[model samples]
Target: MSSENKIEPGDVVKLSGAPNLHMTVDHISGNDVTCIWFDGSLHTISHKFSLSALVLVKKKGH
Candidate 1:
């Protein structure tokens, strides 16, 4: 595999712009990525965002 970052299911990700809390990558279709995260009220929220709109989160000190 190439030494490049790639997003996959189960990976943690967030919005490229206006990032807040991180979301889990539930799935991907074409150019859309399905993300799931909990809201302030601890409610599960599922949303679809374009791949270009998401950034693969790299934890510090990997």
Candidate 2:
């Protein structure tokens, strides 16, 4: 990913332009980032999203 948006594995992130939706970073390559999260479902299926349009989420205690 870009230096401005450094997404490491285990970091919680969300789409920069979307709200109320969140995901965790799995892997990052160049300007793309792989995120995994659950999409409201009864199957409990994990959804993987590859996006370059992402923003970082600050964890508590920095």
Candidate 3:
């Protein structure tokens, strides 16, 4: 991973292996991260994933 790819909370991300899903970073701990994505109902759904599985999509707007 490059320094530029560093992930932080509030950043929008897409899994490199799963392009169809886009999620937002809610929390990170070591190599694990808590990600939240929208469901068909538009409800926030969260999942735990490896940090390495994600790539930055869009950083949160200030």
Top-lDDT candidate index: 3
lDDT of candidate 2 over 1-62, digit per residue (tens): 56555667778788878767777777767667777777777333344555657778843235
Q: Rank the candidates by TM-score, best first.
A: 3, 1, 2
Identify the runs in model 2 with alpha carbons over 4 angstroms from their true place: 1-5, 42-52, 59-62
lDDT of each: 0.83, 0.66, 0.89
lDDT of 1 by residue, 1-62 (tens): 13346778888888988578799888889899999999999999999999989888853235
- Best-to-worst order by lDDT is 3, 1, 2
Locate the minimum summed-lDDT window of 10 residues in model 2. 42-51
Top model number, TM-score: 3
Cα lDDT of model 3 overall? 0.89
Any idea what lDDT model 1 has?
0.83
Off by over 4 Å in 1: 1-4, 59-62
Q: Which of the two, 1 or 2, has more lDDT?
A: 1
For every model shown, the clashing-pair count is 0, 0, 0
